[model samples]
Target: MSTTTAAAAIPAGRTEPDPDRVARGKPLAHLDGVPVYGWRGAPPYLRTKTQLAASRLKVTAEQEAAPLAYVRTRDYGDVPLHDPAAAVKMRPLPSSTKARMAARRTCSQCGKVRPVVLRGRPCSVCRQRAEKAEQRLRARTCAGCGTVRELPYPKHGRCHGCRQEQLEAKRARIDAWLAEVTVCAGEGCTKRRGSKKAARAWLKQHDWLLSPANPNLPDSWNSPGWPRRCTPCQKAHDAEQTRRQAENQARYEREERERRERERREAEERVRWAAAALADPGVVVLDTETTGLHEQARLVELAVVGSSGDVLLDTLLNPGEPVGDASDIHGITDDMVTGAPRFSDVLVHLTALLDRKRVLIYNKWFDIARLRHELELHYRDRAVREAVEEADPAEVAPEVLRERAAAEARLQAAAWLDAMTFEDVMIPYSDWVGEWSEYHGNNRWQPLNGGHRAAGDCHAVLACLRAMAEDVPAASGADEVSGTTVGEGGPWSRCA
Candidate 1:
C-alpha cells in the first residue's frame, strides 16, 4: 500500500503542480490520492503516532479528514502522519502514581530508594553477601591441617605445608630403599646406584616402581614381592615377560593350525565315505515337494533317485487337503494332482524302495515327519478302519476307534522309520560346504536351490552325493550333476 516515487508530487502527464509540496517547501509523493513522504521527508509540523504519544497528545476523530498523510520508512512499512496542532493532551490517570514510581525506585530488600529502579528486587549488598557465602561453603578442607582453604587444584585436598611434608616423606622412603638396592641386571655388569640423593634422583628419572605413592611396596624396603632390583633389572624382567607372551601366541597359532588341519582331514574322510555310499546301488536319495514346511505339511509329490542316478520312483500324490501356501514354491496345485495316486496307494512302492536300504534324504526330519503325518491321516480314514482293526484295538465308537488307530500309527511309523537306516545328506553336505553357525553350533544347512520340486531336489541330492564321492570341491546340492543344471549336460544327464 506504500510506494516510493521521485520527490516530485506531480506525475509526468499531470499539468498542474502540487500546492501542498510548494507550501511546505518539501517534496511529497501521492499514493492512491493520499500524500506519502519518505523518512525525515515529511514537513516538521507533522508528527507520527509514537511521537504524539511521547508528547502526551492524541489525534481525535474530528481531526481525521482535514490533512491525512502517511510516512513510509525501510524499517516500518507505513506510519500515519498527523499535524501536532490537531492533537489534544491526553487525560492523566488519578491512582497513587507517585507511590508506584517511588516503589519502583526503592530496593525491597533494604527499603533504600535509589535514583534508578532496582532490578529483580535484591540490592547489590545482598547479592554480594550470597555470592561470598556460597564461595565459603564450596571451599575445600586441607587434609593434613584440617583447615578450610581455597586452592587452585581443589581436588588435591591438601594445603602447601601438607603437600610439602608428603614430598619430603617420599624422598626419605626413596633414600631408605636405595640403601637396599643390590644387583643390577646389565648382563654381568654389577654397576649399582650410590645410596645418596643422586641415587633417588636417578630412580625418579627412570620412574622406579618403589614409590611412596604406591600402597604395596613403598612402605617397607623388604616388603614381599617388592621390586628390589635397579632400573636395568626391571627392564630385563619386562623383556622376559614379552618373550614369554610372544612364545605363547606362537604356540596358540600353531595349535589353531593343527586343529583346522584335523577338521579338514575329517571333512575329507566324511566326503569320501559319502562318495562311496552314493556309488553304492543300494542307497536311494529321497526328496519331497510338500504343501508347506516342518508343520501341518502334506506332500504333493515324492521322489527317489538311485545312487547310480536312476529315477527309481517319481510320482505326484493327491494330498487330499489343500496345498496350503506352497503352490508357488513347487508349482503344485489341486488341478495338477487331481488324478494322482494317494500316499496310501504309493506307500507300498515307497516302502519297497526304502526297505532295508540305506535311505539318504536331504533334510530328513521335514520329509519324514510329513510322511508320518500322512500315515496318521491314512489310518484315521474310515475306509481304512476295516483294515486297521484286527481285534477291535479300542472298544469305542467308529470315530473314537479311528482316533485310536491314528494314535497307534505313530508307533508303527516310528518302527517303519527305524527299519530304514536313513542318513540326512544335508548335514554332510553342509559340513563339506563349511558354512559354520554359532546358533546351532554346527555347520549351517545349505539351500538345495533344487527348484523346489520333488524331482529337482532328488537330482540335487544325487548330484551332491556324486560330488562328495568324486571329491568335488563345492558340495552344494544345488549344483546338480557336475555343477551344471541336471538335465542340460552332466555325468548323469540322461540317466535320470
Candidate 2:
C-alpha cells in the first residue's frame, strides 16, 4: 500500500534540494504507504542490521525505529529512520588499539606477523636473509684448492675440480674390481690376492664367459667345459661377434631384395601373358553364382561366355544343399534347381569347354579356390565308393568312371594354369580405372536390366573389358577390334 500523495509535500523551509545527496530527510518512493530510500541514498550514521553488527553496536529487533531523520521514495510516500548513536557500544579491546593494529598486520614476504618495518614494509629482515642464502648456493668448495669457487654446472655442492677428482676415484675402484676376476682362461690376466673360486663365481654371475651354443654364457666355478677370458679378451670377442652379425644381416637383406625383385618380374610376365591371351578367340569370360561366399558354399549356376558374345556354357546346378539366404542375391531358388543336373554330371562338359581356353574370371582367386575345393569333394566321395567296392571287385558304373576320370583330368589341369592361366578380369580393370564399384547393386556399373546372376555378370565382365580396351590406341592398320593397335593398343590398356 502506498502513502497518500498528499504526504509527498515536505515542509518548505527544512532543507535545500541536491541531486547527488540520497533521499535521507527527502522523499524518494512510496511503498505500502511508507517511503523507502534506495541503497545508493543510505547515510553512514543511519546503519542497516549488518552494518550495525559490524560496528559492534547492540540493536534489538523489538525496539521501534527512531524518527531521527526522514527518508522518501517514489515507491514509498514517507519512511522513518534510526540514528547509530542510539545503539549501545560493545566492550573495550584486550590491548591498546595501536598494539592490536600492529599484531594484525602481515609481512608481504614469508607471510610472518611482525611489528618491524624497513622502508615502510614488514619483510625487510626476511628479504636480507634470503639474499645471503642465495649468494652461498652460487659458490661451492673445490677439492684441489680447498677454497670456495663457482662451478660450470652445480652438482652435489662440489666445484668442477672436486667432481673431476671424484670421477677418477670411481674409475680406479672399478679397475680394481675388474682386475680381481678373469673372463676367459686364455688371457694375460691382472693378478689380485682374492680366492680363485670366488673370482670365478663373481665372473659367472656377471656373464663374463662365452659358449658356442649359448653365445652369452656366464662364467661358472665348477664347469670344466666352459671357457673364461680376461677383460681384454672379452672386449675382443664382443667386437668380433658384432662384426659377424653385421655381415649376416647385410647378406640377409641382399637376398630378401633379390627375392622381391624376382617375384615382381614373374608377376609382370604373367600379366603380359594374360593380356596376350585376351585377344584370342578361345578366351572366355567366366562367372558363377554361388550359395554363399564361404569356403563351404557351392555353386548354384555357372556361365562361360566368350569375349565375342558366344555363350559357351550356361546351366543351373543342383548343389546338393539348400540355397538358404543366397536365393535373394542370385534369384536362383531351391525349386529352380530341384531337378537340375549336379556339378559332377556336368564336369565332363565344363572341362571340355574350358580345356585349351584362357579362362578370364572375375576374382580368380576366389573362383579357383572354390573350383579346387569342389573337385576335392567329388574325388573324396569317389574314393570312398571305390574302397567299398574293392571287396567284391564288381564292375564300376559308367557315371562313376566318368567322374573319376574328370576329377583326375582337372587335377592335371591345375598344372596347365601356367599356359592357360585363369586371369582375374578385376586385376586389369582395376589397374586401368584405379577404383571399383558394385556390379550387382544399384550403381553406375550395375546393369539396367539384370545382375547378380551368372549370365548377367558374364555380360558385365565383357562390357568392363571392352570399355578398358577402348581406351587403348588402335594399331597401325588394324581396326577390326576397336582398340586392336598392332604396337599401340593390345588386349589390355596400360594406365597413364
Candidate 3:
C-alpha cells in the first residue's frame, strides 16, 4: 500500500511513530495491509544497497529503488531502498556528472584538462620544468634600496632588503616630530631630554605631558600647580612627602600608645589571675586523645589530674561515631567506649570540676582548641536533634543536620576558646631547658616517658613543671651554661 493509505490506517492517537517498533537494517515490503517487513522474512534473492553494489549493479540518482516508510519516536516517514535486479545492466554515467568529477583534478597552471595523477598540481612533467626554470634564476635586484641579493626559489616583486628600507622610511616619517626640542622648558628646571622615545615615555608616565600634539616642545608639557618638576626637583619633592609621612606616622603612634598601655594592664591582670588560680589545690593538668592530628578530629578520651596528683576527671567518650585511629594512641576503642557517656553527658560535671581553677596543659593550644571543638560539636548536635524531634523525625536527614552542625560548631568553637585560659607547661619547660640551639645532642628536655595518652601525659607535664620550678632560681631565666654542658647526659643530669 502507498504511504498515504498506510498512515490513514494507523490509529488517531498513534499518528506519531511507535518508538519500540523503529528498527535499522530491516527489509522493505508490503504485508497484508501495512508496509513493514522484518529483515529475516525477506527472500534470499532480494538484496540491500550494499549487496547490489557488491554485485556491481551501480545504483545512482536516476536508477534509485522505491522508498520504504518506517516509524520512530517521531515519524521518520520513508527512506530510499535498493534491491537486487536480474540481468543487471550498468548504465553510463551522466555527462554533467562526469564533468564535475573531472573539474576536481584540473590544474590552474597548464589549462590542459586530463585525468590528473596528483589532484591539484599539474602533470608532474610540467611541474618539474617550472621548478628547474626557477632554480636557474639566482638573485633579484631590489627597487627601493637598489641592492642585489640571492632570494628563495620563485622570484617575486620586492626583495627583503627593499621591504626593510621601506619599513624604516615609514617609521622615520612617523618619528619626525620628536627631533626639535632639547631641554625642559618648565620654570626652575634644567633636565635635558635623553632619547626622544624614552623622554616621551617618561613624560607620559609622570603625567607631565599636557598634550600629545607637540611632544618635542616642553612648553606643551604641564607645570600648572602640580609637580611637573625636573629630576632633581622631583627628588626634593619626594623627600618632602617622606618627611610629611613620617610626621603623620609619629602622630598616629602617639594616639596608639594609650590603647597599648591599657592592653598591657589587662594582660597583667590576666597573668595575676592565672598565677593565683594555679596556686589553688583545684588547679588541674589536662590532656586529651583525639581521632587524628587534624583540628577537626573528635576527642575519644579526656583526663584531668589535680595539682596535688589526684585524678579529678578521667573518662572515655563515645565520639558519636567510631573511635578513630586515636584508639592506637590512647588504647581506647569503639567497643571500649560503647557503654561510656558522650562528652555532652559529662559536660556539666566536667565544667564544674575545672571552674575557677587554672589548668596546666602540655601543648595547651592543641588541647584547648580540641576541647573547644568537642564542646561546639556537642551543643550543635543537641540543637539539631531537638529541631528534628520537634518537627518530623522520619523526614529529618542526618547529613543535612551534620553540615549545619559543622558550620555552627566552627564558629562556636573559636568563641569558646576566647573565654578561657590554660597555662602551657611547654612554654616554661622550654624556657628552663634553654632554646634548641643551647641544648647539645639529646640533652634537651623531652616529654617524660613520651606519654601521649591523656592520664599519663598529664602526669608527665606535672613532673616537668615541678622540675622547672625548682631550677628557676639558679637559671635566672637563662640556663644556657648547664643546658649545653649536659649534652646527651639527659635533662636530670643538670640537677645531678
RMSD of each: 15.6, 23.3, 23.0
**Per-residue lDDT of 103 in model 3:** 74
Q: After superposition, which runs of candidate 2 have C-alpha atoms over 4 Å from their true positions?
A: 1-279, 391-420, 436-450, 474-496
Question: Candidates ranked by TM-score, best first?
Answer: 1, 3, 2
Local accuracy by lDDT, each model: 0.70, 0.62, 0.61
Tens digits of per-residue lDDT, candidate 2, 384-442, equal 56655663336666566656656765665465344455777665555443333457332
Please, what are the lDDT tens digits per residue for candidate 3 over residues 1-496?
Answer: 9999988997887667555344444546553333554433333344545566667676565445342322221344332344444326467779998877777667657756766644667776688888887554434544445565566422334566665665566446435434423354345665654457754565557663333222233434333432345677667778989999999999998877655454334333433443444457868888888888887788788898988778888888877777677777767878888888888888888778777777788778888877887878777877677667776657867777777767777777676566555777664455345435444633244454535677888777666655544543333313335432211123541211
Q: What is the overall TM-score of model 2 with all chains considered together?
A: 0.38
At residue 356, candidate 3 shows an lDDT of: 70
Name model 1 segments beyond 4 Å from true: 1-236, 239-243, 380-406, 435-444, 472-496
Among all candidates shown, the one with the greatest lDDT: 1
Q: What is the per-residue lDDT of model 1 for residues 1-496, given as tens digits with 9 covering 90 to 100? A: 2345543665767676555433353436676677787776676667777888899998887655544677777788767788788789988855798678877888777787777878548777767888988666556666677777555335545677887897777667665566545434346656663445555555566564544345233433343444445677778878999999999999999997677556656655766777788768788888888888757888899998888778989999998889867898778888999999999898888889999788888888888888888877765563345645564646556666656667777777777877888888787767666655789977677788788888788888877766666654423334533433211222321112
Which clashing pairs does model 3 show? none
Q: Candidate 1, 416: how far from true, in Å? A: 1.4
Candidate 2, poorest ten consecutive residues by summed lDDT: 210-219
